[model samples]
Target: MISWLMLAQAAALGIAGLVVAIAGLARRPFGDLALFAAIGAFATLVVQIVASIIAPIAGAGPTGDLLEYWTYLLSAILIPPAAVLWALVDKKGQWSTLIVGVGILACAVMVYRMHQIWFVQIA
Candidate 1:
């Protein structure tokens, strides 16, 4: 993975997590901003997946286990949409906001791990 791209994605995920978490704490319902942030977080994962594929062809592949990295990539890609769906299904209370918050946090952690795997051999 590219270093800058990884950092940007991690930061975006963290920001999204913080936003949703704050909304949950404030007892705010899911809204456009939250939805956009969730989409943005998910889109970041999609970009990461594309980068993962293109990087090797561009001679920038990670030094870690490709299978493991791809597994994490795929899983990370699923999180946002799944959380959004769950939130939509459970329209009552702050559960939706909470789920999005937790999902973004999980994405942040997963992205950090992906970065680690990418740079493991170099370090």
Candidate 2:
């Protein structure tokens, strides 16, 4: 994974997490802003997926276990949409929104871990 791309993904997810967290705390339903934020973060993961494929071909491959890195990347990609779907289905108000926020934050952390697996850990 590219360093800048990883950082960007983390930042985007972090921002989305913060947004939903604030809305959830304020007792707001899952609104357009939160939805858009989640979508935006998901878009970043899509970009990361493409980058992961291209970066390896360009000789910037992971120094660690490629399988581990890809697994993390793929799993991280699934989180946002799942959270959004949960929020939509639950309709339990703030808790549902908070769930989405927490999910996005978790994704950010996973992205950081992916960075470690790709660039820091070396077997």
Candidate 3:
């Protein structure tokens, strides 16, 4: 994986988490702005996924636990869309905010795991 790209995505996930959590606290539904931000974060994840795939083919797999890395990768890739779908299903409801907030939290954790996996061998 590209360390810089992973870092960027992790930062994006943190920001998105803050945005969604604040919206939830404000008792507001997840709005277009939050959705767009989530999409941006997802895009970053997608790029990271591609990089991870390429890295292994280029003989650059991380020396850390492969299963753990893959678990985080899969979770990171799946969370956003599930949250977005939930939000869409309850567009006018406060539940959307909580759902998105949870999504953000999940992403944040996943990012941390990826970072750990990426650097564990080096450390």
Candidate 4:
């Protein structure tokens, strides 16, 4: 499951990069990219949340390490919207790139954290 999350994170990063690249090269607002990343982040997090809810309900374990996963998941879930909202503060879209760019980087770190929590048994 964590591996799947990692893959999704990687895909999100790629889509993020596509948004960044397209925005940069085309001289277009990064808002489009931010929107793409935000939507993707929300969808991916929904899958994760549903899985987290069901995994334990199906008799997996007490919490199934919810404490371990929550920080990473929550950060990933919040990043896109936060970035998008922050992007809204600026009409020129400079902030959009900042938010989405950092969001992508954050996703990479979250992927690592997920592996650390699930496989390495780290808190």
Candidate 2, residue 86: lDDT: 90
For each candidate, what is the lDDT?
A: 0.84, 0.85, 0.80, 0.65
lDDT of 4 by residue, 1-123 (tens): 546665666666756755664565565676565677667766777787676677666764332366767777877788767776776776585456665666766665675666556555633
Q: How close is candidate 2 to the true structure, as a TM-score?
A: 0.93
Candidate 4: where is the Cα deviation over 4 Å? 14-27, 59-65
lDDT (tens digit, per residue) of candidate 3 on 1-123: 777777777777887788787888788867876687678767877887888889989987887887888888888888888888989999888778778777877887787778788777553
In candidate 2, how many Å is residue 45 off?
0.2
Order the candidates by lDDT, highest first: 2, 1, 3, 4
Model 2: lDDT to the true structure: 0.85
Best by TM-score: 2
- TM-scores of all models? 0.92, 0.93, 0.87, 0.72
19 Cα displacement, candidate 3 (Å)? 1.3
Candidate 2 contains a number of clashing pairs equal to 0
Which model is ahead, 1 or 3, in terms of TM-score?
1
Candidate 3 residue spans exceeding 4 A from truth: 121-123
The worst-scoring run of ten residues by lDDT in candidate 1 lies at 114-123
